[model samples]
Target: MSKIFLALFVIILVVFFILNINFPLKKHEIYGKYVNRNFDKPICCVEAPHTEDTLILYEDKTFESKFYGAGTYILYNGINPEIELFYKDFNHSSSAIYKTYFLNGIFEKPKIMLNADMNHYYEKLD
Candidate 1:
């Protein structure tokens, strides 16, 4: 009876390991609505135009942006985490890559900066 119990335990452990390998868990903090408020200012320069764009990140690893349209996102975890956006209708081509960072060391106030331009960024809306 003891041997049978040990064998069952081993089988359960193997199944759990396989499941984790096949589907890894993802971070949930990055999912939210981010907006660029600089465009709302009346006194806007050539670099920052007068426009309002909002980015919504879903828990399913998908995102929708006013300017970028709808697409799926992949988060690369490391020292500096990065998000890669791929447009759904663009044959899975990469549209943009954003580097995530916290503002004033506040985790709740996270911001995603565009890799192409440091000044261009989206702050999480509380």
Candidate 2:
């Protein structure tokens, strides 16, 4: 009985540690390192760090930018992949996209959706 209890306890501890832990942590900053000359500089980088992921743009509302967007980011393809992230909008999807080296173009195509009709995708000039 003592051995069984000890084993169960160890298993629980391992699981607990695994679930609460993140690995190969992709360290990112609130402000991205790069800048775009033509477009407005990105307002800010997300606080959450990720090694492999995507961000979708949408029309309006402040979950993110002025565009509707979705993301489905997973770091691996295992029973317990180390990372997980995603977002999506049914009507309009990602148009401007970002690519990563690891996925090798399989999940490489990020997109930006131009939501002009729904709620005035962009603010109008007075």
Candidate 3:
């Protein structure tokens, strides 16, 4: 009976190890720096001010933005995966606001679109 129990335990451990190796937890695919694609800038001007609005998403589920301020974000996974940003403050002013934006394109380089509008979107920076 002791030998049988030991064999069963070893088999279970091996199965668990194999499953863990084959299927791991999915990492956040949207963690990266994204810049507003519509920001106008001079192409020929090397000294042009870098005033493009930027959004930075951290691995810890926190995000910082030039327009929306710093706060935590939730990524809703589905057929139409969306990201909800809870703004803590903006421009030193305190206000509680949350905005939902749709994600488009591939996982490697996604465009965060406003209200499903493709024209108004932030492209992930490589």
What clash count goes with each model? Answer: 0, 22, 0
Instruction: Write down the lDDT that model 2 would get.
Output: 0.30
For this target, which candidate reaches the highest lDDT against the unseen true structure? 3
TM-score for candidate 3, please give it.
0.57
Clashing pairs in 3: none
On lDDT, the stronger of 1 and 3 is 3
Which stretches in model 2 have alpha-carbon errors above 4 Å? 27-64, 67-126
Q: Relative to the unseen true structure, what is the C-alpha lDDT of residue 122 in candidate 2, on a scale of 0 to 100?
A: 18
Candidate 3 lDDT tens digits, 1-126: 999999999999987766543121134557889887744533432211135778898989888876776788887766566677777553456655465554553333576764233255677785
lDDT string, candidate 2, 1-126, tens digits: 999999999999988876654332222211111211112323333322212223322223112322224343434423222323344443545333322211111212211112212211111111
Name the regions of candidate 1 deviating beyond 4 angstroms: 1-26, 39-50, 88-104, 115-118
Task: State residue 72's C-alpha deviation in candidate 3, in Å.
Answer: 0.9
State how far residue 90 of model 3 sits from its true place (Å). Answer: 3.6
Residue 77 in candidate 1, Cα distance off native in Å: 2.0
Clashing pairs in 1: none
Residue 123 CA error for candidate 3 (Å)?
A: 0.8
